[model samples]
Target: MILCVRFLLDARGEALLPDLLGLLGELTPVVEAAPPDTALADVRGALRYFGRDAEQLAALVRVRALALHGVDCVIGAGPNPMLARMAAREAEPGVTRVVPGSADGIREFLDRKPVVALEGVGRSMARTLCTYGLDSVDRVAAAPLGTLQRILGAKAGREVYDKARGVDRGTVVRNAAARSIAAERPFSRDELDPSRHRRALLSLTEELGVRMRGSGQVCRSLALTVRYADRTGHTTLTRSRTLREPTAHSASLTEVAYAMYEALGLQRARVRAFALRAEGLGPAEQAARQLTFDPADDKARRLEAAADKARARFGERVVVPGALAA
Candidate 1:
């Protein structure tokens, strides 16, 4: 069984993600880290060792996280990664939501869900699907494959059709996300200005790019965590995305971080801090670069290299982007 765990951590507490991954490691070796506050654990093997089912193990893991780190988490249990991830979103903090590992059970759980609730269904596609009356998972699943393909290209349609039916073939990849570098920017005070938040994100990506380039590494994914300024209780929203390819480019990193921040949909919420993590590091020499035809894209890469050298000789402040300049 797959257990998707999302740690409810504040910006400052994102540094604890690795330790939380370790806590899961004690239960199973197939724990996949999806930082800045999530992980997937294939606990099928650990069930017999611990003498508990997936749901029981999830509860134990939650209690252990709170007892050991004072971190509350929600867990989603399913037969595969996709189902588990979807289940996690439906779960509240400090609880476990399960998608039963049976064909009938999976269908019953997913059928009534909104089509937009499926991961990777963009806003545009959701509208398009809804136009055709495929507003729910069951409706999408019931639609003919050829019809969906005509609406949303062949590849995406096939993928969506399979997902709506709770058919996920992905496995828990045992890559070490512990080999990551993180950068955090805390507001001098809780700030509400969107422009300032973006500036901080840009500054952070700049730092991450310089650090990764200096270390001769490239990251395959990035994570962004936002902390709210509520003193009574710390509230954090985190989201991570895998890049199409490995890169240490500052602009690319900045773009992904901005998208993540926007996706959180926190309009005018009191923001206290932001945390970014670059994960799945590999030697820069081993990474492939996608060729681009645009001169601007080429120039940006050239300028990035030059900026890295300037920062190495001078200082980070010496090579700040125009947007980051006060």
Candidate 2:
């Protein structure tokens, strides 16, 4: 069985990912790192060795992650990678949800779910399918393959048709996690204030910028993930945008991050946590910056560099934006 595990970590918790993945490695050698905070483990062999079912093994891993690192995980266990991932997304924090491996059980679990709930079914695809009266997985499952192919392209339609019937031909391949840096902020409770959201975003971006610059790395893209208070489903929404030019500048990262947040339009959202990841990292010197004629932009970049120097010499909190100081 495949087990999907997710953890949303802060900048301070950067080293915790490997330790958590290490915990999974203790359970099974077939561990795939899904960085910033997730991992997948294939435990079919471990199950036989430990004399435990998949869910029991999942529970053990969850317990170990919490006890060892003070981190809670949403874990899902299933016969394959796709179902395990879907189950993990459906699970509550610190919970392990198991999907049945049998045909009838898989059918029953998937039938009533909306087509949009499927991994690859995006808004446009859902809209197109809905236009043809295929709003649910069961409906899609009943549609003729040729009809679906005619509506969607042949490959996409075939994949969707197979997925609707709970046929996932995916295996967890072991690989190193992607190169990325992450910072996260978790609220004490569901935070409803947009101002507080902005504050958290600012703090997180500052952390990311400082870390990237200090490491001599620049990122090509930024990703924002918001975890909502509602735990029944859709617990996290992630949106990522590639920058026009690679940068390690705090201001540029902030600009793109704010645009992504504003695009989410999550006014008064009951947010439990926020995570920002800088992806496609490379040496800072290797990145090409866009030439700008504005002195103000240059001044901002100069200020950013100065701030980084002060942060390194004194401490992180010694030089922060006035808003954050407040």
Candidate 3:
């Protein structure tokens, strides 16, 4: 049986994924990494080899992760990846939930969940469905696929319809390379200055660039999220027209990061914290850097390289950007 084991590790440190994967490797060879602390393992072969049923095998995996790795996990076992992921999300940490691979079992599990709980339905889609008086997954499953497609757009609508019916065709692909560098800062006290907020964002982007360069990844998309004092958050996404070349140049990440923030127009907004996530990452070799006759770009790249070297030799905060210091 296919199983999607989700580990909601302690968010304090980055040791979660490594430890979880090491523990899972003890149980099976067919393990796939899910980002931000989650994993999927195919235990069908291991189940028979170890003489344990699906549920029993799931329990063992959870126990091992906790006992050996000091990490808490939520295990979801099913016949397919989609069902397993959903089941795991619904389960509490340190428990194993098994969705029997049967029609009755699927129906029983999905019948009462909100339509939005299905994988493809986002908040907007869920709101739209609720407005149309279909608030539950069961109701969505009973709706015609054509109707769902028309309402949610052809692709999203079709995907949601399939998910509502517990139909997922995705296979767990293992060892996917890391594709982004993200950093989030929570303020000790919520502040109202847009300039200070911008400074914090700049600092985070610089940190991200440093880490990205160290790991040999370059990003193509910039995503910014601002958490307000009211606890509501907004996210803005923008992509670079040309692929950013694979140097961990802070200037490059900072330019795109600041541009995305400026586009948000958060004038004098009271923000509690800010996050910058650089997505669509690839190896530096894979990115095509534009050959620029612009001297400033070349100079900035050189300065960034020097700063990175200084930080590596000394420590973080050795080379703080002027704006961030303010």
| Candidate achieving the largest lDDT | 1
Separately for all candidates shown, the number of backbone clashes (residues 3 or more apart, or on different chains) is 0, 0, 0
lDDT of 1 by residue, 58-177 (tens): 988999989998899999999999999999999997668999999999999898899988878988999999999999999999999999999999999998899899998789999654
Find the number of clashing residue pairs for candidate 3: 0
lDDT of 3 by residue, 150-175 (tens): 88889988888888878898876666
Report model 3's TM-score to 2 decimal places. 0.71
Q: How do the residues 11-123 of candidate 2 rate in per-residue lDDT, one tens digit apiece?
A: 45667888888999998888988776788899999999999998889889878877887888888888888889989988887668888999988888888899999989999
Candidate 2 C-alpha RMSD relative to the actual structure: 5.8
Query: In model 2, which regions exceed 4 Å deviation?
Result: 7-15, 92-95, 185-221, 224-242, 245-251, 258-275, 279-326
In order, what lDDT does every prediction score? 0.89, 0.88, 0.76
In angstroms, the error of model 1 at 194 is: 12
Mind sharing the TM-score for model 1?
Answer: 0.72
Cα displacement (Å) at residue 96, model 2: 3.5
Candidate 2 global CA lDDT score:
0.88
Which ranges in model 1 have alpha carbons more than 4 Å from their true place? 176-182, 190-203, 214-326
